[model samples]
Target: MKSILFYLPTVGSHDQVLKGMSGVNRQNYRNMLWQLTEQARAADELGYWGLSFTEHHFHVEGFEVSNNPIMLGLYLAMQTKEIRVGQMANVLPFHNPLRLAEDLAMLDHMTRGRTFVGIARGFQKRWAEIMGQPFGVGGTLSDAGANDRRNRALFEEHWEILKKAWTTETFSHSGAQWTIPPKGLEFPYDAVRSFGRGLDENGVVQEVGIAPKPYQHPHPPVFQPFSFSEDTFRFCAREGVVPILMNTDDRIVSRLMDLYREEAAAAGHGELRRGERIGVMKDVLVARDADEAHHWAARGGGFVFENWFGPMGFTESLRRVGETGPIGADYRTLVERGLEWVGTPDDINRKIEKLVTQHDPEYLLQCQYSGLIPHDVQMRSLELWATEIAPNWL
Candidate 1:
């Protein structure tokens, strides 16, 4: 299976705070950046497919503070030669469509076409509240029926505008949520109005599009990160966007892939091939022995389960899906349920092979680093994965 490293640049001290420590050490953000860059270089040299980053804001716990993944993507692009750099998702509602489109196009050019775009309707309520937009709409975990519908509609409108901006030379949009070059404005009404000169002689707004289109013809590959909604699956299939599955079981993934294939055929996109458009992410840890692997995986997994998912209300969601037996449990339980992989290289390879035979995923994203795992330990796990497990797939 093709492999990608899921990078979340969390400050080590944040874990201490989560554990109720009286005081926490302050970490230099620059050092974290340097470490991540180094890791990206290693992944590149090791022949990993790509590195995917997450986005968050106002997260004091530093669970994932990558507010601007495009900026990080640019840095990684410059530091590496071949591996693709991408965001697991750029929260769609949190950004201006035109600005996001332009930035992604620039990243594609800067990376020499080694850019991947993954879009999502953001989940964090605080972010939407800060931006004066409604949160928890459509497919969000906290969604309440109608409000969720409205939020999803807004996301769709914004996405439509972004796609048009990238693919069309001169496009005009009049959607419910936005109007480009907004109507009913005189040419010289405002100083900023004259900047783009996007107006006709009759004072009507004119069509506009991004300059320096993109390095990839049409655009770079677009991916939709995992969501439970069939609508998302159908949309990805229809648009030829790969779907990245995470935290879900193989049965669910297999069902979703079947749905995606059926939708693709219905949409005249032809039959979906095995291992072509699907990707899966799993928490992976490799060590000298099973005991060492379990110890570290338990620490990291428990921390993530409590600190990250607990506050976000995702633990209950997983319980509803039968992925977890209870909150605040031991990681061994999770491991037994196939939610995580922690063992020797042979053990990991066996589990991964089972997944590959069952799901036929095009890519397997290894989530090796998270919550309190020492940098050196994480690196060692990665090394083992590269030297021992990766060759089997090849």
Candidate 2:
């Protein structure tokens, strides 16, 4: 079934919005939580399949106000029944694998197996600065590649550990980065043959295991969100990770699918399976009439595009170690890029149809709440889309 997922952003307007790509504001966080809960409850009633939260550390433009996606997921699970809850992603490098395992396990149980985990290597530099760390800044992928390689390795490594922790009776590991202490003398920490799967030095095998066995029988579905990089796509296909394409252009999505399927075929995997979802994130606002949508967007969406996507598209600049610039300096450039799109239900539907036909995505995620948008207008947009647009698309 084609599903709709919503990206909930809970931050107001900001001056240094680009500095922390996904940072959450404290006051805004409280306000958004209530708004988000009401929205999710509505989505459940409306038969939407899932809702997702993005992870961000420090961005001035109000990308993500709340830093804790897992906590949010659990809260949603407790509040709702049918709708699935998840993180659009958690940057693997910024996590402690063991704690992640615990959180995922507890959440899966609480949600009764409605948790989807999207993992990625993050791209924001201002967040790095907040942590007193350094990265190749200003769109420089100098060490990003190496960092990605390490992050991927560690991410997969921890995935194994978490899997082991869930299924095995008393799992023990002595890998390069992790070692689970032995439980006791009576139990040798020998997980069952069907505990879980992991990679050894050689090739793929099903004999290995991870513990506290996932309540979902095998495991919860794991996806890696990517931006259509050939290397990244190939890696995802090879590693049995689902490809969750984000902000991928129409042409790029087609090329990626072909390449991904070809590689999977060459690997003797027959046809690519299970990795069918592609995520298109757009700044969307829907209204009963075009003018209202346009006006609301002109006010709210303009700021979102200018503050959020503007810096990234043009000059992805960040001070090195310790540098400074006027606040909102990049906002004008972002506004110039023309990233915001606002329209009435009909116009919005036309654009969506074009995108859907071009990309043929199995899912479309609407980033409806963005950039300090007013609560009433945002709700109207959601309701209109749910009532007018969604049924037609389905």
Instruction: Please list the C-alpha lDDT of all candidates, in the order they appear.
Output: 0.73, 0.60
Candidate 1, 234: how far from true, in Å? 1.7
After the best TM-score superposition of candidate 1, give how far the Cα of residue 377 lies from its true spot, in angstroms: 1.5
What is the TM-score of candidate 2? 0.74
Instruction: Pick the TM-score winner.
Output: 1
Q: What tens digits encode model 2's per-residue C-alpha lDDT throughout 1-394?
A: 2454546474654333444533445765666677777777777777777777777765444665546778887887788889888776776656666677677767777899988777766666567334324322111132446555655566567667766766665456777565555323232232422443342333333233333455675567666654446777776666556666643244456777777777777767678543354455455777777777766665554555455544554222211223355324233332233233467888777777776666656566665654466667777777777787889877
- What is candidate 1's lDDT per residue for 1-394, written digit by digit as tens? 7887777666553456455431223553555676787778887888888888877776666566577889988988899999999988887866778888999999999999999898887677776557634432323553556656676777778789878988987788998777787777555445536666566767666777788788898899887775666778887888888887764555567778889889888999888786578787777888978898877776675556555655675443234344445454346546655667788999988988888787778888766454457666777787888899999986
Least well predicted 10-residue stretch by lDDT in candidate 1: 19-28
Misplaced by over 4 Å in model 1 are 13-15, 19-26, 132-139, 142-144, 185-203, 316-330
